[model samples]
Target: MSRRSLLGLGELALLPGGAAAPLNAGPLNGALSDDGDLARIGHRWRALATRPGTAAVRAIAPTATSLWPDLPYPSYTETPARLLAMARTGDPALADPVARGIEHYVRHVYTPGASADGNWWNWRIGIPRRLLEAALLIGPSRADRPLVEAVDHFVHPCHLAAYEGHSTAANRVDLCQVMLLRAVVGADPARAALAASALTPVFPYVSEGDGLYRDGTFIQHSTVPYQGGYGRVLLSGLATLFAVLRGTRWATSDQRVFDLVEKSFAPFMHDGFCMDLVSGRGIGRHPYGDRRRGREVAQAVLLLGESASPAERTRWRGLVRGWGFADLAPEAETVEPAEGHRLMAMSARAVHRRREWVAGLSMASYRIAHYEHGNGENLRGWHTGAGMLYWWARGHREQYSDHFWQSVDPYRLPGTTVSTLRLPDGAGAAWGGECPPARWVGGATDGHFACVGQHLYGLGSTLEAFKSWFFLDDAVLCLGAGIRCADGVPVETIVDNRRTDAALTLGGGWAHLAGHGGYVVDGPLRTLREERGTVRRAYTTLWLDHGTDPDAASYRYLLLPGASPELTRARAADPGWVDVLANTDRGQGVSVASAGLTAVNFWQPGTVGPLTASAPCAVLVRERGDGTATLTVADPRRDLDGLTVTWDRPVAAVVRGHPLLTRARTGRRLTLRWGRLADRGGSSKTVVVRLQSAK
Candidate 1:
């Protein structure tokens, strides 16, 4: 075995105990910083300390039924911070109380292994982290020895690299943080070095597991996309570590960690809002909506900028500033536009951004759970990952935040076609345990435009469908085909299940929900208005019923976000605005003439309008308003080594193409060929060609 194999991760070969002196308290405190944002730690210290009934009764009485008197488990951990805050007051009267509280914590409550109940993390990471931070704030104390020893008893040196559990991604970051704090409190340089060195595993991109991916996708719990939950934790932890370890002997210099600011976190956030699609079960938690999560990330970015390079610092600040100011001053000319589209094929998710709005689509595959349910949260998120479409607009800032998840119908989430089979709470699976038997769950995008597709297999239900969303500049063309179910229950395709108080008005075969947007549908549309009040909120729901045991049912619709009712009526009347070329089990395609874009999801060798593929693929052709045209293609199935696409349009020459694009020939028809796609991740490959006038 290699030498690295012997040492294991985050491990070191240390010399005898007399080798070097332990690090002093000053540098560690300086590294942690008592100024800047962290200085706010003591702002409310007096209130927390003086809150008469705040103490944990469980600490005073171990057999107490409630974990704490009035607070929660790990709320006792805040005692150290409260004491430190009180010490900062320099009032002699407070000193005895602070010291006694610290002694009580070290002796009674956190007395090594006493916190073995509940989650392992609370004992090992949560409690120790709070204690050490407060200790640093309070400077040094004679109580440090016992306090640090108590921490070490529960948190072992190699706990980050233990045989199993808590050894990857966010958990690893958390463990490393605890160890670093433990080192500072214990005055041990060896532990600090080991803790910093252990962070290397989290820096590199992982191929098929937890941690960040090359495509800017972050996964936790093996098969769940958790950019909003665990990703925030990873980002926040790294931001603190990067700040705390700067210029120290144990400082991390990995560029990949720095790169994540732009690559992983930035794309999904808009106007200080992170999409619910990547939030996992955290979406079901109270008061933790998209904007709240976005604000947390924005704050973390600002903190991270304190340790980032000057250029990186400026760029991150600009992003945060934009998200902060985007919704403010509506009368001003225009805010910073969220202009682009992102296709995270690795995670089966996509996002499209425009100046007026931002939209996201969530899907599931063999590699990702349909929706995660654990800790008794998100019990009804069975259809969240089955092509749930959500968006944010100018006036609809608090749309989803107005108690939507707790109130909306889980089976009728927007943009999802689901079987109305009744299921129990915590249905489907828990902790991302069950993966939907679907692999064709990705798309092709060219930064500005995208065509996403998903061959969905319903979670814990007998439902299957091929859904596609072609994102245009002003509207999204949504299509679904081959929608079949065998559960003998009604199958419905949700068109717009929105939380809005605006009256729904129908005119000219199009429906518009004031203050939100409008939708143009092809088939019979049903609407329902209801009020849900665990706090009492209103919702507007629209869907198409495919009867019981639907077979090969289909629907096509156009979603115009932030559109006026007049514009909706105009588009509904103008067939030239958007044309549905084909809607069948084998293929689905659309042509948005106004945008000069034609896209298709070919389930097999078939034709959609003038486009034909030799195998299953997603193809998008955009006329760039110039002589040149861009063609993007991908094999979402990831089972093709080669594919040929032919567009029946006269082409002059092949301009440029991807490395895998070996053949781009021009004749009476434009022909493109690609190979070497086996074992690929369904990433998009684009080729540009010079188009001649159509015959």
Candidate 2:
């Protein structure tokens, strides 16, 4: 745990012959601490390093090359990893098994013309990567030539300047890793240089398509927000490359990667768990839950700190410490106590982090997919992006893990208003095909607070609604209007579908789930409890039935995260915490008089409370109650030349203005105008104003 030991851990992390840590470990297991806990790392390595039992290794059919012919793709790659682990641990007793494993890989398993049968990834990167690493680890063994040549047959595509269409985002980085290892194993500096050069395209931010955007959105397959799935792979690969290639001719020079630790990834990580909303189809993968993904990210960040600048390294170390030590001790201070709120407009995602809890909102525009189902995963994620909200409170970071994905009804994910129409397995479309054709999917945020909305378009159904979420300090106020669908199925707004065994209590138009939080509803709230799936885990679901084929039906609710049952009842009884100033097709607005905060989603030229917007826009105002206020506005539709707002309150002066604010008038009615926003990609602008006191 000393500074010297921490530095030593980084130095030895990527040395040849070191056992590679498994990327996806079990939930809440394998957290790498800031002090560089070597025993934990060694324990994980030994878990992966422990070779198959004598009988299991002997079960390799004598004539067959594959260790497991019936499961050739992934099972074949495990041999070299075991061999490398044995070699690194210096186990003379297991030397023979390592040699036999290497022989099997070179002679039979990975022999020339080994059927390229399964997923292309297995043949190209998976198999060759392990073998190449084993070669580097064992240090120029006599079997290097045949090993390189055998891997060459399958990995020739990686050596190419371009990996065809497979060279983008995570796939590109994975392939580059293979190329680098192949070069080191083959003793070809030229190949290593090629690998380093091939990585150039992966560093810079992209305007669109499969890459990291400027606004911290990590997209893959050109649509799915994969900050937790493929994005993790990209970061881990980069960290390995940075470590293994350090000081070599093939070393990477792009420093932008260090910046991504905080900008592109940290927001999705809350209390040691990656938010599942952005993980796409990977959420359905067994044993790779949000906590495991978060641990993987933490590991990568720790490794990345070795090459990061001092400021970035300090920040990353604090983050890794926070994630690793979260919930370990309730009394201990965390690295980020008050993360505030963020709206990643490019990814159509928002997160609000409070001291006691964190909430994430996932929405998809035409630019992003609603959900992705491919390779037989996430088949029932039809409503993941329908304004789904995922939150975590203290001591409940494990809520989304432990068979939650398998047992909970996918149709009733919390924070989503979905139709009761039963969807077929793998419903809608795969890849990027599930995106709704709506551009008004982003929001306006002042960093500390935000107003996000989605102009809902049904997926493979006739459902449409306008949904919005106002994130405040105490609660998230949700409003939905213009709900219309004609598919002969009931439309329901799921207040929550919690995975818990605790008692669910309902009283006075409010519901509370023990150990979770509370919901204040504006309609008759329906509740149910059922044991689901093989785990027999219990779930409590709360929703409002909008009935079948209704028009213009609306819903309003307040989600008070971490609120006690008594507090929830009191808030429900008072109903003055927030006022729904308007809820209609043209506009929806809410006001918190105590906070002096008001937000509105203007669907058209309409008036809401004391504010009128002349175009479709999202607006938020924070009044100081001392004759001063700050206004934030955004054109989420991305088709406005200009937007004008007239407020009933008179303005004394424009204290400050944003770059997009073209005009501001101080008169009986304050007027503000903004222009040239069509190309701004739905980013928000803010201006401060001084309001004249009413005599």
Candidate 3:
């Protein structure tokens, strides 16, 4: 019943190899007074490190190759480095298993081939390529040349230059590993090229400042019943990338990364809470992840040890513990034994001599960061930012900040821990986190979200917390569906208090969202009278309340991306598609023509379910020449936003505009290239050209 958590280290001692340490604390920053409660934390870390366990850590060690999870598979080969860490700690009792796990990680997670790969895997490119941090954690002494080669191979080609010669979600993971790879390997030619080339995508192509990140959102075209939340890959990826660049010795290598981290770091934390910039908002206090806070402490401790400013490390410590306030309740929280060892392994830089500061910093940081009220975005993440957040959490607080807090055994679920939502209509659907399944309907991109993938991700998807994202053009809207204001309440109208009816709060009733953004929709747009919670407007545009963060206060509306509208008319189009566009202004020509225009929202303030699709989303009746039946879509972003008219066969609609995001052409009978995002603040015109489709 110790308030302090523990990892089930039973698997550590049973390794097949020789002696190994139960844990390696990693680097520490001595940013604290020589004596005090912090010193006590240091002692605790020491005692925890010595605590017996890791039976399996030894069995998995020794193999030259990295390991991958058998069932769920692994996201990276960090598990191997994690194992070597056990051996380095000199735990004596856990060497064997630790070594074996290391072997398995390299062999399974890193190999690139159909045989070793998971059904849906980025591992071949993810594990080894990104294992540099893991290798560093294990120390250069333990990282064999093969491991290094694996790391290099994975990142250089797969991660850095995979999609369209730019960074995609997968690329982000690649880049994430690059930090550690570069860290352990030093600045070689390959490393420099990787860094420079990857650098372009990081900025302007990706983040907030310039393009460090892709400034937008997207929804995968599936058929389940979900849309991407505030971010893709959960928003955690973005933050993690920041932590890695800043934590490892690489902090000085790239000023852009450093600056991005510093600038975005504040919003990512937020008074301790780590919510998705989009949704996943939590109230109350905050909490920290075991790994992330630990990493911050490690870095802070290292800085302190190296004679860095004491204030900076101490400040980071406070922020570290503050992370654990409200979101996340990983299965590990319920486990016993090795959890303690895992925690120590993640935080204690024991071999580094003066790591006492690490213990204190980690504890304080975890306490604050972990408990912060949030749905998950910052925890597991909920946007294109997932790679960044993951890198941060896994690199630093695998035990707390990221999915490790939620994962029972890091080695158990591995890659499976991360998943995407079902296509709103049940097409090719998959999801993560916990919850009850929701309904599906015909909308813009695909169908809709499971309405449950959010909860499974621990971000309360019912509230529209977790989601995946992908981008083709600069314009994207990978975002979340809104949740209600009354915290702890569901968005179902049937459940009343638990439900946030669209008609209840009006346009952001609980959100304090206000903007003058206008959009252009072909033909006469229907206008809905505004009420308390919901508003009957032509197209549902996104509004940001800023959640009390003045810095993050920003607004954007969806717009025409790439769908070519073939036909059009008042309030609804004939048989066409609605293309989404993007802009940062707050003014444009807007309308709600049918045949392809929809709006989906994450963290939508008020709602009810199965929401009456009667208002926001309407079924437009349409037909094909041969007598096939299909539905025209309008505003697919909204849970009930799309207005569709079905046809018997295929239809060709050219949706043109500035703010388009993605194209979704999935359906048994009809294909759709719906808007990824539309209605940005700008004046625009629409040209509709109708055509028939091929079955």
Candidate 4:
């Protein structure tokens, strides 16, 4: 079949079985358009066309004869494919180069034995998809037989089917794309149905294992939470499939896919900044990994927005504007208040956002690794997932940007409790080293308020601590307990490790690190600066020196992001804003009475305020002040089959928006039981129940 004829077979045609019908090329014709994107495509084509082809390949990849050795060689195919797409839009300037580039790619790059087996997957799927896209755009003739045969040889149906039950989300998405594209170009109805059916396992959501968790965490390469790089690739591929299948026989009716774009994915984005936790070490290794100008979220919004409904388009456009893509929609304003908190149960990470500040707390459970090691970066980041918090507020979006790789002490990440034991240069570099299983590794939140805790085990040392953070409206209350290390090294908890040339101020039980924020320590505080080459960073840290006593030590402080010296002192003196309900090795609790909220991390059954639980759990209780109260409960360790809570008030309760089946009132106490924590599944394993005071 000729390329034009293959693409023209857009009308739905039935197969022998009741399989999905094949779609025409109409959706691929005029549906995707972006002027800036087109201009960039044209520029890439012109750059390749002007260069001496052999000389360009040699200069780009002098080490080997294979085209894949050259990083830009893949783009050599992708650029022409995109240009050919532009040619159909009546751009006559790109016609000649698009044709010439294809011939060059087939002759030099696509030759047999030129591709390395190591990247066989990319050559088989990634390269062929682009070539096929270009051939379909430019009408195929009898002369194009070699190109079609080359693509068919590399991306055969059997090879694509082998990856049907792959563990990684990105791999599955890529394989599906190749299958769908090959089915379209080859005019094979059975392959198209196979591709459509294969998507059933991955589409909408994958809550259990290696795909996208319902909590919005995307696990790739099996264990890495890859919401930035690999996750974006999955999202882009899915968006492309959605666009191509729109109004087709294989169209999806699931709204959860759309919900992923809005709810799960969008929360990780702030302005144009993506938290480095999701980006992994790309922020330090890649040239474009600078956190200041992240385009992952923006690109996804643009591509996905193209296929979204009018309402979703407006919402995505607003997001694009907020990401500083103002040229796309000049009138759209940034989303305001950006206020909410989400604890991704699967990854054991919490994201808290206020109007003036945004904080991400990285924690790890036995189910997830404390930190990733491949790529030569973050080799010493053993403590990143052990209660390491990254804070971004006004004027400090790029605080740790650029200098995080080797400039700062990896052990002194802000909001982390670390023993001063120097890591042996490449310690813990191996992939997939999870922390020891411990209770209180997760947190609880009710949208605006959050309480996260961790029973931390220091990497490569005998150090243990209980770290907790209470994310309130204006300030974050940090608490630590059970900090005991027998290594004789001092234990320190970093309040803020920021990159700035600003001077440090110490007075009135408060220490201001820079204009970004300050710390109100409950005890003696220490301030220091470390110099790397010509760069210097100031840190406001608290110290715990335990010689050999196994006695549990504790510390408390308030992190005031975007606060001035005056405000820091005022908050340090004001005890009314925060109240420590319980602080011990067994359990930790806090109540922000002004917010009418009490949060407890119970290592065992304990009491905080008028609420008590019968087992180890994390609970967040909010008195809504309107005869109603909201309670969020979770078993962070994921061990409890069930737990019960008794509140000293007569009330009727509803769990997850449904009235509980078994609830009783005895005297003035209301009792509720949440059962089958493991059966509920997902990382959260938590339930939100609303209680109304009985009349």
Candidate 5:
């Protein structure tokens, strides 16, 4: 047997009494400068903190109650591992549940009979995700024979001869395990040397870029975009890397490495939410989830807070709070933080409270809540991976469609999916679904666009075929959806199921997409050459592209499911929208609703002509034609909750000099109500209006 064969995972090492020195207290006070910049900007953060009502007990998942092997792993089970780690450091509070967490992992991580080999389990083995995970947990000295043998087999044709090392991003995960094993086995030089040998070939995967898109920044494999929550995986990779560095002696704290990681994460922080983008028209599915891989980034940022400059701390805090990840909050409703959460909270120990109540509120107006789609495409937010690369973002990105299994980890959640990565000690949401009697799919077409660093960048698209991109923090979002084409089967839809209030404002802060991507574009918008993933060309993926070439198509109705729309008073409406071009698969003319702005060309690339035909569809006419002329189209596929329009600007309309409640205001003009639609009982109530030009 190889020397590494002797070392096994789960082995605990006793620190040499004479050799190891006790680590000292880390930076606990605020950043070095105590710069008031964050304090000032954070004034808003502090004000929003302690947001009330996030704590009201929510209804539980009625059906998911009795589900077993529920979440691949609750992650909460790692409590024992956490307690042991913490107890060794002299922290007493880490005990109670920690033991239970460990026990859970031992019991559930590998359920016998679940796999072909009674002793072996599918813990994502075919995919090799767990091998890397185990490698990260196993240190140099402690190598489980089976685990080492498994790692040996998992490594693809590479220098170290391991599939675990095949993926640069995956290797990062293994990096952590290798160190963990080393620590467990007393960090013997021999084990460290062997582990280092294995890690050698994997370093080339790290690209000079800040971060990767959809995958790691390694230049070789980055060409293919995997979207659908790939960002969360990146987050997991970084988190694992950080833990490995801190836990094992294999790596030293490198400022450059950490800086790059931080800079790579920059794009996620928009306004206050780790915004996928500021705005878009439909439920743009930028599935940057709130948890998953990002949890590690949160932890790393928190740890950096200890030694960070005041400005850095402020920035880090903003990133953490900006992700719109209330679920990760200790007080979140759907999900709660325990030991893993503690790691995140404490890591930010360097974070100083400017105000006792400052909270994180994404300046980006939840974009998905804006436009409605009947399809389930936009709902990837909760289950998908993080914007900065967390698993849930990927899960959500992949969960809604038939391709959802691509995003499934085989181990996660209480049911449906995520059973593959299940770890007894892992922490995850028990219930992740909308409260309703309906769980509908296939209504509208959804798409995603993001600009993470090359390390992780790409857009999630439902167009040709469902595909996604992550790690593109530097790019802009461009997505168009056809809620209902002239001829297409209708679908059941829901727009704002998760949000508390239904905001109908068209233009606001950064677009807040609930489970999809949204965009608010104006000015010199940059154009991106489509970087299609391999799946984009798959016949079954984009069934629409059966034989049509995108370049030759005269009119394309990129289907946008009209599920549900958030009806609010803030969004704008263009009543003057003209019918540009309407192409239907069935060659039938669709009913252009005057209420929701049937269709308008806000911005066309190159020289795509405007809708030449006077639109029976809703149109937006600026008093002087400055804002935009929007033509809206509703979901013929499904009935929308409601359709309301807000002008580009705020207007308090006065008819005969009397200001009224419901009026379309844009750019300082008097907003007389143009049109409105209400879903009283699943049926729409249409409101009509005429522009009297009171001005």
Candidate 6:
């Protein structure tokens, strides 16, 4: 069969409007139903339609002066295509101007510089895809030919070949979309096959420098973990292409892509908000990030749901409903359950969720940075990567909504342990690749519980500390040790720092910062206030002020999100809820008996409770009450080839839900060996072993 014969375009051509019919139906079968979405699309259309020169095509194109020359035409091509789609939906006023705009775009707007710079990849893919949809809606005409020919410039073999090894996943997906659209519109199955073939490489393409890691860390620009920024672009492009290719010969059946969506992308969402840790500098760059809205993830879920089978659609619908987006909620009940705690070891990020609260810990390592100091955004985000933690519950989202970028003290971010040295004005504001030079900067999790540790090094200062966070069911236990700095500045560990109008009270070994939950302080506590613009917000900052300590200093604190004053007082009075099993330069460990979980971060080979390991590792154990315990072990340094774990109790072990072969029982002691740790693809060398008490 010829490549062109596979698409069955002849059948599609005879159906009402030929190649242009699908465009007229609106993108993704009229998925833009939200009032905000419709308004934004309408506004874009109105602006383009009312532009002075859009009503008529130019006789002579303007000379190219600037790289992106303004040619008395709409700079963006997608606007006109979308407007034409809108016009077909009973609004004839948009038709003439849109038709004229498309004419102007093909004649003058698609310039040589734009084509050569490859900046037009986004427009080349998006505009033509939408234009084809518009043509389908408006019916075939002379206008359709020009639009199709213009898109050919993007999807031609020579142009499409350049993006084959593009640095970012987003660019690759955009290229695939262009190829797929050209294949569908041109009725060439060869291009459709090429597009389908392009998508397969991206599914398992784990770039050692950038792209999706097995631990769910998405990196873009080679160095930044951008799950919320460029990662969104990649996911949205895939979702749209999947929707367009559904029921077609080019449709994908790759389970890895679907697994990435459900397992990797889904965990980053909490109540429709992508955690800021993976967002890079997006929060400081745009208002959307500040609002904590995970709109891209929501849109992808909804669009994928539209093309999903009955069972998968139910699961996608349930995930969307839990995000708290009222518009995406389905009328029928959805059976998909909410995700639990996760420690993305490759990303060095931890997400802890309870029934009412969701908290995220953003840490920096030799691999990740505190913040990206580029693109004129996030210039002042110095401490965002120093174990910065953000927790959201009822009424807490609005607390720091407007205060993160320009307001609030950068050194006093919640869950950060830092020196009090003020960052020199405009120190790291310039564009440069700045990553923390630290190792052993990751965590371990058994699905429900996690332990994250970082050997943190201060930027532009000689400060170092061993910081750790233990995420339990109801609370996060934060510990800091091995603190030493010759930088003359006082070192302090900040716990629960946030902007709140709620009154603060400090007494009974506990402090309550209203709108930010409560904290059980293991040391001294203080309140700080900063005024920015018209907002005067107070911050209840709990810290152990180690002033010029030449030796190691340490501190401990328990963060209880959504806790009442009485509960906070009672918890502070009882220390048994959290046990600090170890706090030293070599290791940091904690046990939460209430949750029946114990976590230990062995800075080196060490012992904690009933378990001992032979190398720098992280261990999380959940006592499952039914004569079985779930043990999660990880070598965060990524150096150990093998490690042996010994338990003081008689037990039999299973690895990744399967019984292990390398096990032994001796004198009531159980031992297991995990070998070839660094060879498990790109994932964290972590293994989940379910151990049952041996009779």
Better by TM-score, candidate 4 or 3: 4
> Which segments of candidate 3 are over 4 A away from where they belong?
1-109, 112-116, 119-126, 129-132, 139-143, 149-159, 162-166, 179-189, 205-695
Q: Residue 534: error of model 4 in Å?
A: 8.3
Candidate 2 vs candidate 5: which has greater TM-score? 2
Tens-digit lDDT track of model 4 for 1-695: 11122122222112222112212221221211222222222222222122111112211222223323434454544544444444343233443444455656666666454664444555666666666555444333331456656766666666545433442467776777767655554555566666666666675566544677777777765556777767777776776565455444565434656677766667777756667777654546643364433465565555565556778867776876775566555666655536788888777778888878888888766666777776466677677776878888887766666555556667777788777788865466454455456656777777778788888887777788888888888888899888888776777777767766577888777877667787878777766665652344443444434445344878888888888888887887887778898878778888787788888888779777677988887888787766566777777777777778776765555444323323434445666677656543324333344455456
Provide TM-scores for the models.
Answer: 0.87, 0.89, 0.34, 0.80, 0.35, 0.81
Model 5 backbone overlap count: 193
As a TM-score, model 5 comes out at 0.35
For each of the candidates, the C-alpha root-mean-square deviation to the true structure, in angstroms, is 7.7, 6.4, 21.9, 7.5, 20.3, 7.6
Clashes of 3: 285
Q: Rank the candidates by TM-score, best first.
A: 2, 1, 6, 4, 5, 3
Per residue, candidate 6 scores C-alpha lDDT tens digits across 394-449 of 76665446545656677788888787887864455343257777868877776677
Q: Lowest-scoring 10 consecutive residues by lDDT in candidate 1?
A: 1-10
The clash count of every prediction, one per candidate, is 1, 0, 285, 1, 193, 5
Off by over 4 Å in 1: 1-68, 72-99, 113-115, 162-164, 325-337, 693-695
Query: Which residue pairs in candidate 2 have backbone atoms (N, alpha carbon, C) closer than 3 angstroms, thus clashing?
Result: none
lDDT of 3 by residue, 1-695 (tens): 01121221212213332112324443211321332222222222222233234324434423333343342345433453455345435354454344335445556555433244442234333444334433333333333455555554544555555434235433443454454345334424344334435544443332111122311221111111000121223123333333223322233233333332223232233223232222222211133333333233223222221122345433433433443422222221221111110011111000000111011011101101111122222333222111111112111222223322232221111111112221122111123222123211112221211110111121223222222121111112222222222223222100001011132112211111112111222222222222122222122222233232122112222221221221112112322222322111111111123322223222222222111122332222223244332332333222332222222333355333223423333233333333422232111112222445444
Q: Tens digits of per-residue lDDT for model 2 on 231-294?
A: 9999988876766565444557576787788888898887777888778888968654888888
Candidate 4 collision pairs? 10-24
Please name the candidate that would achieve the greatest lDDT relative to the true structure.
2
Any idea how many clashes model 1 has?
A: 1
Task: Kindly give the stretch of ten consecutive residues in candidate 2 with the minimal lDDT sum.
Answer: 26-35
Query: lDDT score, residue 47, model 6?
Result: 21
lDDT of 1 by residue, 1-695 (tens): 11121122112113221111112112123432323222212211111222222333223322222222544334554555555455444344444455455656777667875848766776787777766655654455656777888888988876866523667899898888888767665656777778888888888887687988888999998889988889998998887676556545566757787788778888787765777788999896865478778877876776666667878866776776676643322222333545899898889989898988889899999998988988789999999888999888887667677588888888889999999989899886588988988878887888898989899898878899999999988899999999999998899999988887788999767999888988998888999998875877788899999999988999989999999999999989987787889888788888877677889888879899989999988999998788888889988888898999999888898888788987877978998889877566788888888888765
**lDDT at residue 474 of model 4 (Cα atoms):** 80
Q: Indicate whether candidate 4 or candidate 5 has the larger lDDT.
A: 4
* Residue pairs with backbone overlap in model 6: 20-136, 21-136, 23-133, 24-136, 24-137
Error of model 4, residue 639, in angstroms: 2.7
